[model samples]
Target: MRNIMYAAVGLMMTTATAMAAGTPYHEGSATIIEPTDERNPLAEVVSGIDFRKSMIREMQEDEFSNPGMIVVDYGAEIWEQVDGTAGKSLSDVWESCAGMDAATAAVSYPRYHDGAGKVISLEQQINYCRETAMGAEPYKWEKADMLGMTAFIRYQGNGEAINVSIDGPAAATYERGKELYYQRVGQLDMSCAHCHEDNYGNYIRADMLSQGHINGFPTYRVKWNGVGSTHRRFRGCNGNIRATKLAYGHEDYVALELYLAWRGNGLTVETPAVRQ
Candidate 1:
């Protein structure tokens, strides 16, 4: 969700600026490179803009509390199911472990994990907590059980503003991700900016692709019949680009997500459970 923001802004600026300067793209892919001379000024747009406040406003008629509920419901069952060597439930260790009570905590994750030595997404964070902290095995990212647990957890933090940091190592990772967002890659030879930044709000096949904000995720994703994680959607975009996607728990993705969240620092979170 965050990374898409950078791509959208950069794509728009990349084209609009090029036309104004009368700079021509020496290109195969859709991206226009930075011009050497001011008069010949086609340049790659910097991928740091966040556009969530306005984006969320569009969904004011909708809400962000439902996804958490659905997930929380499923998560409770998962938590209660016996597992591990002793076949013990969460009650054997922690009384609640926020199963339903702390759904809001999901909104605050994808944070820096000093032990992991990098920023990790909420999905990854939950798995780690479940494994080491809970003395249970971790759930897979795409599992219905895990996804439900995550949705329920994140649901706990409805209505809070997004806050992300790029200080220290996170800063470098964000910059690199920014560069990756703008650089053309793969057989399509297109970077994220090519479609998202350069062609936002334009018709893509049939859909009028908006600026591609991340505020709506963990979107209800009606297509999925329930809520979804932001990273799952991110990987879908990469697959669409024909680019070899980074892994689910890739550090690059966490870095990119961090940068994106920072870009959208003031945006409100909206979840799937609540329909607009």
Candidate 2:
């Protein structure tokens, strides 16, 4: 009887979620206009302030209490572990090749890499450094160790601003990303701008929408109960809109990442950012 009851409850919950997703956003609910103040443009649109009221926010504030720190700790171990034909640790290679510590390295990511002849994200750079320095095989994109190492590195630059360059070789990619941001698709005929730019600070059902910045990527979402990449979140957003999801590390997504990083130029990096 208990097993039957549990199955029925799960079915009901799934049905409720499906029903909620199918409900359209009311026109009146999204009418809240964004503030025009240039000095504090994001002040009103960002959702962190409201999120801080929750118990999950408290966990994020306290390093000892946050579960995501476990992954960060594991990543530190990976950093020190020797690997590849060169038999150098990630830390050794990063110091020798990049001439910067992991903490500061993340701040300069999603930038053009002359050797690769394209823009690269922090995750890609880490893998590249691994391969070039040690001749080690790169970790898959969604691997826990990869996520952990990314979180560990990004945590070092917690308060630094996102400073992705949109100049020279990166310029064309940035333009393409901008076009994708405004291009409407899917059966719903919506673009990123329709929800994030047009209706930021407005209510979508019970949740308030924000400008959807990527500064807090590799974030620890309460919904996922795990750390996820910006690409993962991007794919989630696409799925929510009924759009065909792109593969992780797709060039288009990389371009989009560069654009979003530039869009959030001044925002502080909030790796392992706690979110619902």
Using lDDT as the measure, which candidate wins? 2
lDDT by residue for model 1 (62-140), tens = 4443444556577667766777654666434432432223534444455666655667776776665566556678788
> Cα lDDT for residue 73, model 2?
89
What's the count of clashing pairs in each model shown?
15, 0
RMSD of each candidate relative to the true structure:
10.9, 10.2
Candidate 1, residue 36: Cα displacement in angstroms equals: 32
Tell me each candidate's TM-score: 0.64, 0.80
Q: What is the C-alpha lDDT of each candidate?
A: 0.55, 0.74
Q: How far is candidate 1 from the true structure (C-alpha RMSD, Å)?
A: 10.9
> What lDDT score is found at residue 118 in candidate 1?
66
